[model samples]
Target chain A: MATALENANLLSRAILTTQKLRISVSKTFNHMKDGIKVSQDEHGAPKSFASQLQEDLFLINESFIELEKLTMAVRRQREAETIGNTGALSMDPVTDKTPLYPKALETYKWATRLREHSAHSQAFLNNSSIKRSSGSGGSPAKRRKTAPTNLNISTQAVDNLVMNVNRQFHDVKITKIQLNPTVLQVYVSRTLQAIIVLRGLLIERVLIRAHHENTLNDDGTLDLWTASKYEVFQKITEHATAASLRYYLPTMQDLSFRSFMHWLNSFSKLFSTPCRLCGKYIKDNLPPTWRCFRTVEPYHECCRP
Target chain B: MGVTCVTQWPVTENRTVPQAVEVLTKRLDALGASKSGNFGVDCETYQSVPTNVPLKYIHVMHNKEQPYTCYAVTDNRTCLVCENSFEAIMHRLNGFYVPKKTARIESKGTRYEMGDFIIKIGIVSLGPHARGVLVEVEYTPCVIIQDCWPLMVEFMQGFMGAQYTPNTHPMLANKQEVPFNAEDTVFQYLEQFENFVKRGSSTATVR
Candidate 1:
């Protein structure tokens, strides 16, 4: 207990030092100058901040897509394990591993590759004379019709995958499925996914900003991180495993979802009732912070990061 | 993420002017809130929340290095730079202040003043439709007590009645009335304050 308290004190001092440094830097920059307001973001948000945020999300998005695929792959692996003379959940780590499930590796790689496609697409946009989408500025009914497609990885594949995965893992659910002739994105959540995003720092920023946004403002603007972020992350952290954001970037870092999950799962046992919100078997009592009138299977505050 | 950081300022939702009237009526009964009949405040349908903090003044800033902090005509950082800097401060005022615009300044009556700081009250009124007018007042309040508005920041505390009072942290320190820092001459602050009022008036329409 004394060590924990000492650590907390040290952390506070470190945080204060950083804040003071920023303050000191700001103090130095004060000098009289004439200026003009030229245009709205005529210069744009500090490019550095925007680029970092965009890069992080791009990799995370791929990581999530891969994690979705891995959930299915694991179900497939579990199927093989079930049929082989082993107990339902049991698989021989050394010999029974087989070929690392070719589909899982493919899914992981595909997830990691998405960042590259995004970067190339962005480059293509900048290189060409085409302007970014300001808005469609037309009636929705007048939009272009869909093109034809013939492929096994059609919308049907997603539906089948979701059905198969959900049948095996009752807690998991594919919340959204998006399909384009070219790029496809699927959003799946089972409480665990949201937690992974939070662990990656997305949810914390969103929630902190949301808390500061006062609801009393006359303007009809909602804070970015309402109760929903905590709810989502806490739920995901408890139920899902090896789920995180993943994407590929040709010119940048390629974050892996499975790898992050594998990393996170190593620590999941620390949370006493991980995925308490969605898990079928969870004790009734919940911690004060995580108590929700909405969810019957409540997560403990201690379990949340 | 929120589309814009500025848009997400804290505010109470769904307040009616009549609610303010009722609240004021109750406020009168509250201890130390002027219970005398003469001490009552009247609202001109001021039920809705003002877009900016009440009594907040803007200062001009022109500092070269910290442009955000310098040359701003804001008297206090919080009054001008705080979240709700662009909103109407006072919806209605019973006391009429002389408009700085079109008001003649005499060369004789003015006393020698190199650094004697004065305040400026920037106001916007709904004149003949929603046309915005930025009015500046040379905040020469008759008495120090009349200067109810102060920079919305942590300034030195003054005695309420000769007793020392401790200001708590997270106490919305900017809301209290206090004079400018003694070390930082009042004249410099006033100059900064004037610039704030001008910028606020110009930006009022867009904001």
Candidate 2:
């Protein structure tokens, strides 16, 4: 405890010396500008510029040296404490008074354990004989030649896909398609309106609003951010996102888009269809928002479970 | 703000006013409706004082659901929805229009929630006497009455019986295709209050 108090005193002295060093440096600059008769010596005689600069430089040097010595003393004291406590406690005895040391120790141990597990997993992955692709295991040139080419879809292809889907699904009408950040405003039957955002060829985001709710802003631009006012459509938005993910097939993009449209068309009976399980029109202040990906059967979010 | 249908549930000869309310509430509770809180809607009728000027009644009303807004509906079905401070403005016009104190009517009772529907079973009272029962069923998801009227009818009939479950309310019939607003709800309540006034104290009893 006595050593701890001595170490704290050394730290406080180090901080004071740092402040002293800063003050002397600023005074040296002030003397350089003001020509050094600005301050008087201890005997009340005006000091010469050269002597005042030397005095300020000497003060700065002395404070810096004191600060270094005090920091060294504090470090030695801390090292001694840690060495003494190493047999019983692995952390600093001073920091043990607060929760900081134990919490840090816990975090360190957790990180070490995680690192060990990750190392084992990495070694196992490296040693595993599972080949992802025959061409992927070969030379880079051959792999590049074998890989599929149409990864980045063109704007014309997206327009063609929209037109083809519109022709296939009579209920799914592509009302507006905006460029830059590609967005499609779809009117599905008379039930709901959907906004689909695209990145390259991929469906990035999907939002569903009820038919009565406006899908466009007052200025006649597609409104992509505002969610449906009704809870039923908000729930439908969640299900629609999940459906988008379910139907996502990178290689078969056209099929994926078509399947998504077909699933969305099932929601034409959203308000009309009762939950298959509970056989009720409403539950938890929402209609049957979830439709089965495969069967297209309607179920309330709760009733599905 | 959803589509709401307010209708008067007449008190039969066999059952009194409270008895009728009790029966309806019991049916609602059995249909899994939980009492959320109490709601009240009151309307005060004001008429021009001068005999020379044509008499026009302005019904200044307040609904508990929309506590911040006051609705003043005229005799010709023109409604002006404004801030609750409109009451103070009406009081300032006392020299031109005098309030008919005896014509004050209010409906206050338990509000229930069942699924997406909000059902209010209120006892309609004129002055100090209970006149009838008013049931307001609101399907809170769909705004257009035509879209959700059938669903509301099915739910209402689960407790109110097919005979009592009214067809599309007359006020809502013409505007079925349009989105229902809060004004339509207030107007329906005002019409029901007027009906109770015309029916007089024949079935009224102090409660």
Candidate 3:
């Protein structure tokens, strides 16, 4: 009677542990589904995605180990009962009357399947590569050797590029170019104004406002953050940002900058240019807001796609 | 505030004041202008009391577009753009400048917005009598009149008929290169108000 009670307790404990393992496994899967972002915990400290995932996995491993131990004990108890009853009867009365043995076997099979699935998931996760840092993979000495030759153009090079572009394009005027986190203000004809921000040699941000709209704040400094008040110019700003990405070339910074300026010069006819597709000056009460990057033809937002 | 052009929409032989406004609104609706709301611009004439100082008229004006500012244009054409608190200062100067009760005139009607343009069709009135219809168009993006005048004219011609050529407002003639502001807008309204007063109840001939 005591042994039977012990078996029942072990079975219930195994079932509870299995439920915990299933929950933790699903939790890990859910976390993986949503691309991991560094989040803050209740204490306001930044908790990393990898650490959270590791903790969940650890809980699942503990539950699996406990369950395996319980299943082994249950199997040993069944074996002992069968061996003791071999001489007394052909088959155990309790085993025949109840479906306990079959149920135990089925539970064991289910646990085995869960274990296999979890192992496969673990292997897949281990093989998947995620970029976690900005630094290139190398030792400190090797990194130091490569860092000096990085693709960061000097201020003089940027200035020379700007001067050359200004000379090439009559309408494209680079009014101001400031260094130490480079900023360039280019006035394109009387149509629009553009402000370009650079990180090292790369163009990081671009803002476009109308010619009449003050690109300066009340204090007479270049306004980098405020969006254009007019919707037409706002749409142009979006297009210019895309152009910056299209013209990006790390190896040849000067050529990339010139290409971007050339693309922007197309907008000198922003107010006058009619839509190429619809062949109308105004659609949906807005003048053609889109300009093709390659062809420089104007199209209304709806007419573009 | 961008460059604004305020002109009288003449009340012709066939159309009355409200009828002319209706025609204009219909034309604007057809041109894809959605009615935004109603706007009113009222001007109160104040004359300095006959003292040692010369008698000068100060037109204290309020435009619904610029709710927080008061525009006071002196007879010399110099405009003082100040906070709404200037109304209290005007009240305090009651002994110096006396308000002309009968000269209180306003232009009030529907306002419409089409893309970058704001169109206001207002009925000018003095006391209880309707005076005329004044149409004001504002290109809200471009501040320089010279830069956007052609564009404004093209847009205005769409609804005002192809033959309706708008001469630049007299107030904006010298301000073509200057950045237009709320003062410029209100000064134009004041000019139209003075015209209505001089003409009395006679309908303005379309120019």
Candidate 4:
């Protein structure tokens, strides 16, 4: 029932309105985040969120408004053209200064341009604005929207690297002299090895955390330290230790069996003394009193003693 | 050069999603420009931030087996410390705490700048009570800190992730003075440089 002219006007107005909204939102986000230079250095210019938002809204709105005016003008002008009435619209009272036709044409052109711009603003909103990212990164681009849902690796590549390195460089046993776990007076030589020893502490903790998963989550994922990064961590330790050896090397004594044992002892003692047979005392010197007679009964003597 | 500080993070920062959203939201609101019907952001509204990086997460441009170098100048000589020189300092930098320098560059201008494991400056810190501390003959970090501090904090918060806030406090209302009054120890640094030359390296085995 509506005329062709009415349909065209309606479509143009809709497009114009959408474009204006997009610009406004983009401006607002920028102001709240940083400024014009959301990621600029000090002494940099300020980007007002409120003002920018207004401008964006204004620009888009201006465009849409333009589109609406243009559509109206086109409709009126077209009507006049159809009737051979050039002065017909001139007399109609939409405002003599801005003939409905001319205003509509200008609005339509700008509104279309502004609306076209809406695609980009939407992208920036969707993407995390990788444009300002550091490095020799190129222009603002939409990195395909990816959920951080990376494949849950069974073995964190980093941890595997760490374990591999630790086992490779550190697992070796010194030739003859065994380390005395009870004593703290072992001579450590390689500075690199010392770091290995330190890093091993962290890895050991990770191992324990892995060991602690008594139950699985309802989702089927286990509560273990299964991040793919564990292997990488291991590799890093390996690399660091290898690198450090240039400056300092661990001595035979430093790598003595005793140090390894001491580390083991510490690892096993994460909670408390290892399964004490007594009521509470965890000392190796304690007489076993969990049940029967208690007279110098270090039952688990092979390991504890 | 002996490195007193080191971080494996390489001074680089990473970009995560929600963080991006937060930034975009803020920036867009300030711009007040949006598509007519869109929730937020128009196609043309995205602009890159200037130095949006926090010095903390900003990774070094390059990678090396050795850490970045820091140099200190004494009255008589200049002392330097590279990344690999110290283990503890490196761990701290990369692990949790990122050191921030505070102080003023009195009217004289700074005698030193953080350049290539070498910081050349006549004065390090102005006397404790001095309203404006002096770093070089005059340059100061504080004068600029007032404006840039917030940006740095924001960047750090975003870049550091879990390590940014309550877990890792980036905001330092009051940064402490250096280990030794940089201005007071011309003799020590000068002497240490000499000792380092004699010994081939200046690695003080700190207890």
**Quick one: best DockQ, which candidate?**
3
Per-residue lDDT tens digits for candidate 4, residues B163-202, read: 6432121112423322222222222323322332333322
Candidate 4, which segments miss by more than 4 Å at Cα? A1-163, A166-210, A218-221, A224-305, B1-207
| TM-scores for all predictions | 0.16, 0.61, 0.62, 0.15
Residue lDDT tens for model 1, B83-114: 22222343233132112331111100111111
Candidate that scores best on TM-score: 3
Rounded to one decimal, what is candidate 2's iRMSD?
3.0
TM-score of chain B of each: 0.20, 0.92, 0.91, 0.18
Task: Give DockQ: model 4.
Answer: 0.01
What is each candidate's DockQ, to 2 decimals? 0.01, 0.19, 0.24, 0.01
lDDT of candidate 1 over A74-100, digit per residue (tens): 322233432344332244455456644
Model 1 chain A is weakest, by summed lDDT over 10 consecutive residues, at: A201-210
Better of 1 and 2 by lDDT: 2
Q: Which runs in model 2 stand beyond 4 Å of their true positions?
A: A1-151, A159-197, A204-231, A273-305, B12-16, B26-32, B50-54, B92-96, B201-207
Q: List the residue pairs that clash in candidate 3.
A: none
